[model samples]
Target: MNQQWRLDDGQQTLVLAARSGRLPECVYWGAPLPVTEDLVALHAAYALDVTGGMLDENPDLSLCPQSARSFPGQPGLVLRCTDEIRMLYGLCFVDAQQNGPDLRLSYRDAAAGIDLTFSFTTDPQTHVITCQTTLNTDRPVQVDWLAAPVLPAPQLSDEMIDVSGRWCGEFQLIRTPWSAGLRMREARTGRSGHEHFPGLIVPNRGTTNCQGEAYAFHYGWSGGHRMLAEELPDGRRQVQFGHATNTQAAGTQFQTAPLYITYSNTGLNGCAVAFQRHVRDRIVTDAHPVRPVHYNCWEAVYFDHKLPELQDIATRAAALGAERFVLDDGWFGLRDDDTSSLGDWTVDARKYPHGLTPLIDHIHSLGMSFGLWFEPEMVNESSALYRAHPDWVLGPMDQIRGRQQLVLNMASADVRDYLYDRIAAILSAYDIGYIKWDHNRLLPAPDAAQTHGTYALLDRLRADFPQVEIETCASGGGRIDFGILKHTQRVWLSDSNDALERLRIQHDAALFLPASVTGSHVGPRHCHTSGRTIDISMRAWVAAQRHMGFEMDPRELTDHEAKVLTDVTAWWKANRDWMMRADILRLDSADPAVIAEQQLAQCGSRFVVFAGKAATSAQIQPRPMRLTGLDPAATYCINVINRDHTPGLSRGNPALKSGPLTLSGAYLMHHGVTLPWHFPETMWVLEGTRK
Candidate 1:
């Protein structure tokens, strides 16, 4: 006997079936289909045969629910009972219940005294489903492996797309053929390291930005995670994601992370739009009140914290329209470089004889908020805290140091209390508005306890100081996921400030993350990482679309550069609200050297589009960039926001005439505006409002 269930959120549908009293197996999970009570008939209609030639001899040789079943390959649940028994056999379904948009299925093994429950929830607006499983046992059970949200893929998906890169270059796209076998991408570095971001994109062959079918999955975890894409021998593909758990006692019950999945027939862009909408609506509700333009004093005057020098720099920053000024990395204890004084949180008496009050007061007077950088989870051996409690550090007594610092044993209650108190004291003493939370190293092993402790620490801080905003920075672009987003308002996408390289990183990072949550800063003319000198106009244009900031010193800018900064900041402030609340769209272009993106307001009354030239090509003629996500019947008036920075504006093309161009949304989206032939490292921004 077989039982089938289905869930639909108007746009998409998910179907599951159970055979011979076991957990439910995914039958059909894609676009909506007709409802019917006859699941057997539906299976036959799709011609899905689980039984092989020798069905009678090998009764267990059928495709079963890989989610929580006693299957031979990649068992979802690996259990060891108190009696030294390692197998969980003889499991049978108990009951199933549905409440609104949530479905819960329960299963039990009476002999083993184990109970398992799987939950499925659908967000009615985004159509993104979240799935998770929990296991509870009366007897002590040792759990080795557990998977969540095991998604079944259609047979047509043959290509997989994901991101992998190192420190300076993150989110580099990698594509490969999805063949018959298990392929897994994991991040076990105790952090979501710079490599292997926790998102997966699987689309059919030849899928482009705006066409073809695509599927996406993103794990809402910041610790060790694994994403699996497997194709069984029966031409059935499955995508599974969950937290990486080792041999741990299942005290009473254990629950996995919520794995999110979505499907789109309109291409990878549609899939990405779904994730953005889900995050904006469901994940982050209380967004930062003001996305202020920021300026950091790291690259400008590193470790040289003089009150008069910084005050002068702060004056220049305020003159350039910077609303926030961050003092980075040299204000605490006997710290001049990265080698010493990490754990100590007090202000260096020698640098600031009167504490930080004078500098903080000066910054406030300039109409800019003050932000300080701190690496709270790490301690240097030369610090006072390490000498007091050497046991607070993880690893051996003679530990191997990482970046001249040791990881604080956050799992320890004593350590958590000490760090919390230290941070709280700073918040109490000063008028700080923001904190650049930095994590410089990875944990030594797989320790979920540390991850939990970190979350607890941040949660406590948020509760205590509800007005302070936090930005998560793990080395750089190392700790980014929905898990960390719950606490922090923004993330440092990368340490490399090269505008050209940042174009690719920012473009791909925006696939799942919104532009407002990604921090993009303008660096020096000669970037530290890439050693490439980019024009200030180009760098400012790229940073305008994100949470705008500046890493370089404003005192070093020339007259032209200062004018560009003023213009860019003015444009960003005027358009940030729509950018924060708009639907993101990535336009497909035939030229690989060109990359275009647009943010369309929900009401279709306004939009902003950016087109960048990554490299110069031999072709002299430029491409006509078609726009998307507009009111088809409404007329729009378009104007260039950065008209002065756009080269060759005098050589107007046929599509764009003199004066402000006006056209119907339908005509503009179908027959786009033709761009002028621009050189490499040039970008243009177009602002359109309904007329």
Candidate 2:
């Protein structure tokens, strides 16, 4: 018997049906239907095969399981029986149940004593569908491969978009035409490394920022994961995402990570808005308080942890309108550099003769919160902690070290308890408001159990100390995913704070993550990674768009630069709500050297537009940049926020030295306004208030 089920979230509907005592298959996954209809009749009317036929008999057919059935690419599930291998495609359908917006379908192989269940959930507000699969067996079954949320792409999806980059330069967007063969992106570093993000976007031909159909998928796992986009022989497409499960013993039940999928007809921006809302409301339920303007001591002083020098820096930071002061690295056990003393979480008596009390009190007296950095998952061979517990490390006795450190065996209960107790002790002893939780090294020979251990540790910490905020940093953006975001408040996006490079990185990351959760800091003139010296205004402008912070020493700024910082910080503080809650829009531009973005207020009362020029052009005439996401009927007063405008530099469009310029929102968005084009590597910030 064929049983059909449908889940509707008003705006979208997902239809799935079981065929003749077998596993269920997806029928339709886009748009809304006014009435529930038979999926088989719909498929037949659309000239689609209900079973996708047999792979061998019809070479062009695309099967969902693609197991020993001879379909191309990877199989969805691989099961090792007593003497032979078996796949789930041939299993008999048992039953299905739907409760509210959740659905579960079960399949069973009586002879093999294997039971497989696929669970589906939908977010009513965002219209996002999340799916996961679980396998259970009476006998021992070694499961090799499995993927969740195996989605089918629409016929019109002809292009694919994803991101890839190296350390300090993450989230570089890449778009390519859909073709035959398998496109796979895997992260095996035991963390969501910077090389590839576990998100995929498929769009129709000629998709733009604001128009065309688009579909997006994001895996919520923080550990090793893989995303595959395969184009089958018959113009059919499949998108699969799941954790990298190497092998599992028999009698052990395996559950894959949840995969989220959303669709939009209004292009990538529409997909982004849906994802941002879903993440904020479902994944991260805690209210994200206004992100403070923080001052970090890493770029300023490196490993030099002198109390008096830090006190001086905190004073200057408070004077420059910093709300929090973070002391990064070198504050613990003989840790002058990264070479020694990582797991030893005790304060260095030589650096602070008394204790952290004096420094913490000083920062509090200055009306600023205090934050500390720690890498609890790593340890150095020379450290006292490692000498006492050598078996605590994950790898072999003679394992190769990275960053002069070895990975701690988080899978062990003893190791988890010790680290948790140490961190809990610090939280209990001091008035610490924040923790910069960092992971500097990758886990060697990672297992699924280790990831569960890490999650349990974080869950215990958050439950014990809910007041203290934790920022996840894995050598700059190596562990950015919805799984980690559920526990941490924010993430360190990258180590490179070069303003020009950060513009691209932040833009691409904002596609799936909100700006409030992305940590952007203004670094020194010479960036540590890129070594590019950008103007202070440009640096402050780029960082202000996200969770704003500063990583450089205030003592290094000139008088003019100090004023600029003060003004920028004040402006950001006043407008923090808009940056935190506004809908993001990436504006289209004809010039390659220009990058523009707009943040439209949810209330429809205000908006902010950022236009930056990377290099100067030889053309004297400036082009009028068209703005987006504004009410056409409303009138608005557009004012330049940054006061660093150069007048009379360009020949055609002269700078306006006047008060607020008034114009209708329709005119400003359609006809647009021209900006100064003479100076290279500069940015302009414009604020619009509906009048």
Candidate 3:
């Protein structure tokens, strides 16, 4: 079961060769290698090889590669998987250099798929190995690239290792002070995937002889990677890998996870590698602990809401007990609408007057945190940035005939520096707490001149600000990919904020991301994207079960509306602890209206059930139920936070007062909780403690 892959850096282009003779290998030119059977020449088998570019003649070409040809070697690259986890593992390929470090092998675990690529460099004097696992997402993704301090000996774990399953792994070589890690992505297509590989190091983290960088994480629906760069104390620099994600599958219905390994260079001849905990089988929800429910002023202000108006919203938001207040768009430049304002990042003097300070101060005055919006990766033709840095924008430097209004080239060093400084300055100017950094566009058609430069630019920003949080948005959902999640704290589930749309969107979004990392907000119906009027109650019900929040103008809502919000948010705050710490048990949603529910177990003694009504019609009702999975003698209280136009209802009134609900398999099977025939949007938190 010795499976592996390799790469060869010759006089021509870099060549990547896979281990198996059966599986065809791919070679990436200026653009990605073609996976589909193509009508083109470079991507097809036995076509013209893209050689040259190695002497560093700009290294930019449509098809200038030496060529990475793969055929079975004398003894084929040995590959195997240690676990039957249906995970991808084993050696994928290796790249040999002329005189420098030669052997480069790639390994990946399905548990921690390839969110990052591994790089290893040697320390000159000691010959110690320094390894770093850098993310390849839209933002800076964090991954540790350190294994046990001792060298990897040729010993295998006694655990029954399986050769058929795929597993992901990372390694690195070190010289005297510098370290570089080798990351390998491998997977076996056979049926034996669950077996365990014991030779791998037991993952762990310890305070090392290294300084941590202050950087930010960014993510979206498309490509994502982590950047670990900093504008040093003295403004020098020390960059490492942030975090990265990858979608290993292809096509419309594909699959992926937040999987990657981290390596660190400890002293001695020792290095370390540990599996990161970013992968999951179901939707990741913010319903878990440590995440907060937030509110944003995008739909409310759209660019019309000035500082004072923003202050008004903030005042109410704080009163409503909102934890975070995000000032979306219009705050920057002369952005009157979505079309004209992008690319110009300066504050709109007409609206902001004394800059963003006043508004940020006002938000803090209300005892709430502040967030700002930035569409840094895009440029509008009307933007000052586009006019000033025309060469920095993507399109043919000769002619501005691209379909896009304009695109920022994040790959160039100057462009990357400009964005980093501009954003850092804005964030620093105000006591800004969060950023709704958006990319309203998708990855533009790659130009021979700027692909690597753009990628490098994004990587730099991510590594520069790891502590600040950013939300990834790509024209809503067009760019939502695992590659982007590695760097972002959370991603907007979709541009379509419709509750019904959100049900499926979030369901899909959660497939790889945790709920906390996915944003679900309640906004006005006739949603911004679809303009569909959905029940606000239904919206709340769906959004609350995840990392929940709202994005509408409170002014537009009636007093009843405000109260409904205040009530539901209160319910979230109350039972949030349960949602945070427990493994959610979702009821079968074969019926779309059944929506989603999660059972939160705080401890063996206490538990709570969070449920929502997703249907819009008043006549649709869920049947009554004798719930299962409960201690029969346990005392229970059901708290239903209803969102209909009910008169004079206050928080003190227990909507559905029931207690000590007994549980039996037959009773549970025969009865499901019944709701009002015409139930308004509502969420019920049923609480109990095991006796």
TM-score of every model versus the real structure? 0.94, 0.94, 0.57
lDDT of 1 by residue, 491-561 (tens): 89998889998888888887788877788998998888888999998899889878898999888899999
lDDT of 2 by residue, 565-625 (tens): 8899999999997778777777775566777788888788998888877777556565777
Pairs of residues clashing in candidate 1: none
Q: Which stretches of candidate 1 lie over 4 Å from their true place?
A: 34-47, 50-72, 81-85, 245-250, 397-399, 648-657
lDDT of 3 by residue, 1-691 (tens): 1222222222111222322311222232111123342323333342233445323221111110111222111111111122322222222323323235332233322333432233433323222222322322222222122111111111111111111111111111111111232222211211001111111221122211111111111111133232222222221222222112221211111111222212222210011101112322222222123566688988887768666677888777766658888888777777777667576778888887788788877777777777778877778777788778788775465544322456776656787778778887776677766677666543444221232343354455556655567676654543344344444566665656677666645542332234556677888855776667776666776777677788877777767667766777787788666554443443443344544443435354555544555555333344563343444445444433342433333223323432335444344324554433334344455554443
RMSD of each: 2.6, 2.6, 18.3
**Global local distance difference test of model 3:** 0.44
TM-score of predicted structure 1: 0.94
Q: List, in order, the clash count of every candidate structure.
A: 0, 1, 141
Worst 10 residues of 1 by lDDT: 54-63
Task: Write down the worst ten-residue block by lDDT for model 3.
Answer: 189-198
